[model samples]
Target: MPLSRVVNDPEALTITVVADFPVPVERLWNAYADPRQLERFWGPPEYPAKFTRHDLFPGGRSHYVMTGPEGDKAPGFWEVLAVDPGKSFEVRDGFADEAGVENTAMPSMRMVFTFEATEGGSRVTTVTHFGSTEQLEQLLAMGMDEGMRSAIGQIDDVLADLASFAAERATEAHILSDSQVRVTRVVRGSVEQVWRAHHDADLMKRWLLGPDGWTMTVCEIATKVGDTYRYCWEPEGEGEGFGFDGVLLESVPPRRAVTTEHMTGTDYPSTTNQMTLTPVDGGTLLSIVITYPSAEVRDMVLATGMTDGMETSYARLERDVLVGS
Candidate 1:
């Protein structure tokens, strides 16, 4: 129990919770910046959270769902208002529907999370402001404080497990649901360098080759929304080639991008890929959440050793593109 204090002030229409942890401020900050570690403890023990989208920058938005023991779900959304890197952040937190839209009927609150270095380690103070005294009391009656306490209690375990989320680890994938899978990796480079390596045609050609003998023959890039891009690769000696083409659905330079991908010349179902880059303690955290058409398609793609190929290409990116940059 790292919780040090909890205060509810009806006069100010606010509630504050303070928790301390025996970890560096950077470690504590990364636990929240990376969605993988955040989802581990964002909800109570019985109700584990799954963050489908988490962007910590100002004006960004995050969506998560907590599923109870009996399969009941509670969805929530956060609209980030301000961010000060590892120091603090402010967000408008509220309940949401299954599609992640805000539920206007419920009371929303403004919350500020402040992180600071303490004598022993670090401390995080969270102050939540309600719209009115009635909203404050209503949320209290709904056990909001207790729920927060329970959620913070699990952070210690996540903080201590450093190796599992280390930057040197290979690319890893987590099945978020039957049709959604998130692939994550931390590379030794700045977010800008990594993002450019992905968007620039010359840089991508230098590192996107999956295997040793394969060479990228075509590297067309889509820089803006509604543009389509194509890429093809072939064995250096003599072998059949493969390629993928996609349309850029959304693009936020140096932060996030969304695209729809399918086999180059096939009529197979397409997948929606959402890629997000987050700066962390060690390096840039690259997370790609792919939504397949169905569970069968998701499983089939995994069986094709997708993660292993991605790891190879990312390693090349660090060795050839990022290192020189």
Candidate 2:
């Protein structure tokens, strides 16, 4: 038997695999939606696979981290575009770095998997649509087709097992509290790269968002303790967008740096933010710890979608500082 393409068009390329299994549509759908069920059959059978986080909802996404035979781990994110319980689901897939940051990829595709009930059992057909033929060819040359085929086979096996169990697990809601959402990834890249991205006024503007009329007036790094730095953002009219200042508590060249970030817009005075960098395998682990005055203040900041903001910031850092440099 030879692999065949299902839909071949200028705008989309889809591959469908039809397998008749001795299971119902609901059981198979559970294997696709549930994180635990997905982990069982979501990757290369030879490789130990796991799903880090799987959130199936609009504006929600799932992250799967796969470790290869060489111990190198690669992360992938699937943004849930649509979900119809037990019938069909769609998602946008992309690659990310270790810090759970998405990369720059043009014309991302939609992967839709549908389940239908037949006389014998259930039929699963997965259709992936790329924006262009070049995109489809590029993905195929990258071995995406084979990888997905293996992954779906794993899903098939897991669903067969689930059918024997006769009990479907409930989906868990992915929710985070303000105080519980801590800054997770702190990566240490080359000092020149890091400095160029973080300290440079022009480059900072590309990643960090500011008010309507905001500019970086003062940015000084002494590379030592007791050094003070201030970033002043000017607003258009009568609005608070100034006096964002910090003090360098510790600084070591290309190794570590600690600073205190203060926001004048907040009701409270400020908070203590510490950043540390330690040398690791061919790189460094940069850890950031922000201590708030109270739990209430922390919750308020989290409620403002700061976690998502930081995730996007780190993604920019990876692209500009790590990849571009």
Candidate 3:
């Protein structure tokens, strides 16, 4: 399958399986990092896995059981050798009994989980090494290859559930002062993630726009201090639309950004904007403050219900761009 491949090196007493996922590395890594999630796809199609003691660190160990449709159970254990979040991990894989006792009769192997980010998606390489070629051949004869392929195919289901569970929620905005309007939102993901969501064109396009049916057609960004950025929104039909172009006055990723906005096709005057992001309990607390030249100019922009539009765009950005696929 395109998502997974297996290479059997009998002479070297090893087998390597590399799988590609059409999702972010963090999203895909959840399948293994989360114990409950790991249980969902750790077994073959006919046998489902159930994790018991899951300690994910160096020298930690995890025990699990694979239950067949008819109630047959095959237990297993993993002696974690190393761990690198969202990157890779190493473990010693072996068989065990229902009471979590190791089955010394069964062969053991060392397995490594390595993840890499790709242009189209993410790649995870699982390499298993045996003591000798005989051990590798023994497992191959017991349907190891087929079972692994079947188990890897189940990742799609996990990814779909993750996307739905991480769906975005709503946010609110208010007038902070006569010269400034402030919108405070707790965005999903880490501080760095929040920064990238605002800067990356692909991620920004998913939410950085006004109401429904109005689309952001052009988004050009230069995130340096002396650089400029432009965005354009056009209505679906022949109706006239609006957008804002800005030059960066100050820029600090994952922290703050200051800019001056020049609006087009409106009576709205130029405004200075300050956007600050702070790491918070859940995610990143994003504060957007827009300062107009005077109360008259500020009131003029507010009269156009720009605050309502901003609320819509920010809400979408928080929900869809940062967390969603």
* Index of the highest-TM-score prediction: 1
Instruction: Judge candidate 1 against the unseen true structure and give its global Cα lDDT, from 0 to 1.
Output: 0.93
Q: Cα deviation of 300 in candidate 3 (Å)?
A: 63
Q: What TM value does model 1 have?
A: 0.98
Q: How many backbone clashes does candidate 3 have?
A: 0
Which parts of model 1 have CA positions greater than 4 angstroms off?
none
Candidate 2's C-alpha runs over 4 A off are: 1-11, 105-107, 163-325
Q: Which 10 residues in a row give candidate 2 its minimum summed lDDT?
A: 168-177
Ranking of all candidate structures by their lDDT, best first: 1, 3, 2
Model 3, stretches more than 4 Å misplaced?
163-325
RMSD, every candidate, angstroms:
1.0, 17.8, 17.8
Shift of residue 303 alpha carbon in model 3, Å:
54
Estimate TM-scores for all models: 0.98, 0.48, 0.52
Please say which candidate is ahead in TM-score: 1 or 3.
1
lDDT of 3 by residue, 1-325 (tens): 4356799887878889999988888777756865545777899879988665455557667777898898888999999899886789999999999746889999989999998999988999999999987788899899998998899888778777853324243444445445656555667678788888778988778888778788888888867888988888888888987778879998766566788888766666678877766443356556666777787877777788766776688777766776544
